[model samples]
Target: MIRTGNEYRESIRDGRQIWIDGEKVKDVTTHPMFKPVVDVRARIYDLAHEEHSRKVMTYADEETGEANAIANRLPKTQQDWKDKRAAVELVQREAGGVVTRVGDETIGEMWSLYDGQDVLNEVDPRFSENIRRHIARTIKGDPFHISANTDPKGDRSKAPQDQDPDMLLHVVKETDSGIVVRGAKYETAAAYANQAFTKPTIANWGNDKLSDYAVGFVVDLGSPGLKFISRNGFAGRAPAADYPLANRVDEVESLVVFDNVEIPWEDVLFYRHTKAAAFIRSTLHRYSALPFVQRTLHLADLMIGSALWNVKQTGLEKQQAVQEKLAQLACYREGINAHLTAAIANAEASPGGLLMPNQSLLYTGRVFALSQLPAMMHTARELCGGQICITPDSATFNDPEVSPWLEKFYTINDNWVAEDRRRLLAFARDLLNSDYAGHRLTFQLFAQSPPFAQLGAVYRNFDWSGPLDLVKDAANLSEKVNGSL
Candidate 1:
């Protein structure tokens, strides 16, 4: 069931239309903007076949004895969650940076729908069966799955019918074979990914019992009439020596245009059912938030490392103030670690029998990690000092005429040479100050819906009955108030 790197590469070369920077990418595997991340994904596939990583990256199926990716397997026990976490860690370690929107982080969204099988069945028994089939296929096929939920909703106040109907992706009509959809979705990694669990971004479905906007389906990236018009990629836009993360692991976002793209009957997970859409919207990140928040933990590590190294180079690590900042960063990092660890330890059973991370802890952890990211980055930037921004590019260091002066100024000691200092500064710059950094920050902010929606998840999941009971008992509330509760 597992595919090799070459096999994964060849699968995406199915003549899918992809455009970036005003040029149509001929092959994403070789395209300059995409090649780096594509190679990272390819390397992950290859890792599952490698001797050292095989055990961590994949597990044998009980029935067929086929080695399926551990990332795609349904969680039934605590060990499965731990293994998935380890697999993600292995990937980030190998890539030397964090890359979100990759396969593992997204596949869980489908599993969320999988938990809503009863709701889907209410709309159509076939819809529930479609989700089960897809989840099974993901285990057996090893496709690089991703998510697509947000659309370029034209105006918030007006409905789709009032403005551009294509503002939100919706079914245009139904054919004998399938339904044709016309609209665009803002999806990360869509240009190079295999498929997306396309769904609605609307959390409030209002009073409509059924509408065309209430649709969810598995969209094949290579389907005819689909166009991937991506934003300008960070890779190849700057010198790698200056912005390594950007050049190495930028996951390009695309406006995937469904120009009358047809979703085959088998691919449709839900249709014309607001209840189905509402169900997905409410619980979309039930499982995926674990991995998404985990990535932020990795980002915190990068910030701490970059800042600590910078301070050490400047001989400021021993200062009490400097130590305080480092301590704050540690707290931030461990705060995330604690939430992840506890969520797994206290894992709860999903309605569909899958084990999901404790929902309240997972959601609160997401809010903490993302809500504090900007401030944390700022603190890291301050610790790194102004050198990260004012530092000259690698080219200037290589200039023979300027090299001597730069070396004299940049070199702090024998161990801290000009080149190493420049590298650290460049890394810190890319991590904290570059345009890529801003984009990544924004991605984290809205990746799991907006700030308000994240808080809403926390509100819905956090148990309030215990606190209310405690308060009522302490105050000795009247029986009327208790009855009202």
Candidate 2:
């Protein structure tokens, strides 16, 4: 069930429509804007077959007696959760940067739906069997899966019918074989990924029983009517030496337009069921949040490393103030680590009999990691000093006439050479102060969901009755207060 890097590269050359900066992209595997991340994803597939990483990236499937990706396996035990985490960490480490939405992080959205088979059966019995088959297919096929949730909702004041009906993705027509959907979704990695579990964003489904908008299905990225309009990418914009991370790990986002694209009946997981849609929106990230929050943890480590190296090069670590700042960074890193570790340890059995990280702990961990990211980035920026922003580009450092003067000022000691110092500054600058840095920060802020929706997940998951019961017992309240509990 494992594919090599070349095999993966060949799979995405499906002649799908893709455009960037008004230029058509013929091959995502080789396009300058997409190749970096595409190769990262390709490496993920290759890692499962490599000797050094295969043990961690893959497992033996009992049903087929074959090697399948650990990332796509059903989480039936706690060890499975641990193995999934290890696989994702291996990919991030190998890529030299974090790249979310490749496969592991998004496959769990389907798992979340997998856990809702009962709801699916209630609407349509075939829908339950469809999800089961898809999950199994993902394990056997190991395609580059991604997610699609948000639509470019035109206006909030009016209903979807009042405004442009295309603002939300809906079932336009149903034929004998399948349903034809027409709308657009803003999906990361859609330009290069193989498929997407397209669904609706969180919405107020106010008292509706059934509607065309309450639809969810797997859309093949190579479908005839699909068009990928991507934003301008960061790669090839500057020298790799000056913007290494951007050039190597920028995952291009795209607006995937579905112009009457047909999703086969076998691919449809749910349809025309408001209850099913609401159920999915509530539990969309149940398993996926582990990988999503883990990305933040990786970012924290990078921030800490960049800041620590800058202070070490300048001999600033000797100062107590600098040491305290470094301590704060360490605290942030370990806080994320602790949350992730504890979530798995306290894992609970999901309704579908799969093991899920503790819901309260997991959702709160996501909130803690995302809410504090901005402040922590600011702290890391301050620790790196003002030089990260002011340092000259690599071209100036390599210039013949200016090299001597620049080297004299940049070199701090025999151990810290000018070239090394410049390199660290450039790295720190890209991590903390470049256009890529800003975009990454914004991506993390709203990647899983917006701030309000994130907090709402915490609200819905946290057990408020625990506090209420304690307060009532302490105050010796009447039985009426206990009635609600």
Candidate 3:
């Protein structure tokens, strides 16, 4: 069931309404802003069929006798996680840059459906079955999937009914074929992806049994009323030689307009069930958080690499102070590494018989990776020196009149020539100092919901009773403390 790169490309050329920079895109697969990212996604698909990668990227499904994407397979054992991690690392290595939302990261949310079977079953077991089918389709069809949440929620003070009801994407009408939905979601890579695990954003966990706004479904991005209005892209903004990461790996976000879009009954995962909605909001990232945090690990590596290389070039490595700063960066990197490693080693079994990373370690790792990212970037930027910002563009480096003068000033020795130094600084700039770098930092901060929600996950998963018991035993408190427990 695995597809080739060309097949993946042809699938997204389905005449979906997509706009960027005030112009309607004719074809996402061929458009300038989207071509680079789409090509990268396609290359990931093609990698599976290649000789060396087939084993790493896919596993044979016993029931169907077909090689399915390993990323989409239901994790049952610790080895499944190790395989998924290896596949993700290999894909990152092959891409030459970090690329999230390729497939594996988003597919984990479907597994979250299994975690919520009890809540969703009260809505209807049929909806739960729909989720199961979609999970299977992801493995067999190998479609590009992405998460769709975070609507343009207007006036947080006012309820959806008080303001424009469409602001939160409520059900407009129910047809025999499906329910027609009206509203939007801000998502990355939605303009080109095949489908989305569209669901409710953060909600007030009230006891309301049913509401039009509390809904979850898998939406086909190419459907008739779906419109993609993408933010301006970072690619093609400047020369790739100077802004390498942005040009090849900047994932564009879009505000997708769903104007009376029809969701066939079969595709509806949950409808008019606030309990299901609240349950989903609390556990949406249970399985997905690992891959999301793993992307930050790659960013950590890039930051450390940029800093260490800069210090090495300037002979700063010999200084004890420089070594201490570099070691701090290593600590940050290994902190994330330790969390991910321990999470897998102490993996927990889910209610549905799937293996998830240890909940406490996984969520705590997310907080560590995201909460400290800005500071880490700052440290790396400082270590890279002031040259990353002050350096001229590639055009200036190759200029006939300026080239010789720049060469004499930029060159340190035969080993550290002007060109090599310029390249490293340019890379450091794109990784830490450019517009793309800032945008990426913002994306990581809130991509899996906001910092507060991440902390909430850790709070809920962490065993508070253990600390309470320890304090009670130490202080010799009355039975009242145990009653609270």
Candidate 4:
């Protein structure tokens, strides 16, 4: 059931509407902006079939004995999580950069829905089977799936009913086959992804059990009524040598307009059920956060390597202050490593019999990773020094007149040549100082959910009882203290 790279490419070229920078992209696989990322995604598929990666990237399904993506494998054992982590590390190594929205990260959103079958039953037992079927479809079909949650809310003060009814995606009409939804969601990689698990992002449903906005469904991105209007891409706007990461791994975000988009009955996961919507919103990132936070760990590695190499090249490693800063970066890197390791080490059993990373540790680790990201990046920026910004482009380094001057100034010693110096600075610039770097920072902050929501997850998952008991024992309080709170 695992698809090939070419097959994945052909699947997305299904006449889907995609527009960027005032021009319609003809073919995403061939477009200058999308091609690089699309090719990276394609390579991941190709990797699954390669000799060395065939085992790590894929597993034989117990029932069918068919090869399937290991990333899509339903996690039932701790070893499965270990294998998943190794597979992702292999991909990031192969890709030479980070690419988050492939398939594995978003598939967990469906697993969350699977865990919510009881909620699905409360609304409509018929749709409970929809989640199971869709989860299986993703594993067997091997589609490039993504997430859709954020809608362009018109006004925060007014309800979607009081404002433009289409502000939030809502059911516009009920057809014999399914319901037609109207509105748009901001989704990354939507233009090239095969499908999206569309749902509400609203945190509070407020007792409205049957509101129009309370709907969730599996949407085919290539549907006729779907329009993908993406923000301008970072790829191909500059020299790849100067902005390497951006050129290869910029996952373009789109405001996908669903103009009377019909959701076939089979595709609808839930309908007219506010509680169902709320349940999804709260638990949406439960399993997905593992991969999402795992990506940050890789980024930490990149930053540490870049900074350490910069210091080593400049012979600044002997300085104690510089050594301390490097140690700080290492601590940050290892902190994330510790969290990821412990999360799986203490894995928990889910209500649906699937294995889950310890929720408290996993969610708290996410907060630790994200909250410290900006500071750690700044530290890396400092360690890399100001050369990352002042360094000239590769063109000047190769220029006849400027080449000599750049070489004379940039070349440090026998170990570091001008070409090597230029490439390193360019990389550091793209990683920490460029427009793309800023965009990446912003994406990490808000992509999964906002900072406030991340904190809420920690609050909900952390066991307050243990701490309360410890305090009660320390203070010599009465046993009644247990019931007071």
Model 1 alpha-carbon miss at residue 419, Å? 0.7
For model 2 the local lDDT of residue 59 reads: 96
Per residue, candidate 3 scores C-alpha lDDT tens digits across 192-276 of 8999999998654366788999999999888999999999999999999999989998888999999899999889999998888
lDDT of 1: 0.93
lDDT of 2 by residue, 91-172 (tens): 8889888789874899999989999999999999999999999998888998989999989888967778888888999899
Off by over 4 Å in 2: 483-485
- Each model's lDDT: 0.93, 0.91, 0.89, 0.91
Off by over 4 Å in 4: 483-485
What are the clashing pairs of model 2?
Answer: none
Lowest lDDT 10-residue stretch of candidate 4: 200-209
Predicted structure 4: lDDT: 0.91
Name the better of 1 and 3 by lDDT: 1
When 1 and 4 are scored with lDDT, the better candidate is: 1
Model 4 lDDT tens row, 1-485: 89999999999999988999999988989999999999999999999999988999999999999999999989999999999999999888887777799747988999988999999999888789999999899889999999999999988888788778888999988989999999999999999999999998783356667988889999999898999999999999999999999998999999999999999999999998898898898889889999999999999999998999999899999999999998999999888889889999999988778999999899999999989999999999999999999988888788898799988989999889999988888898999999999999999999899999999999989888887888889998898765333
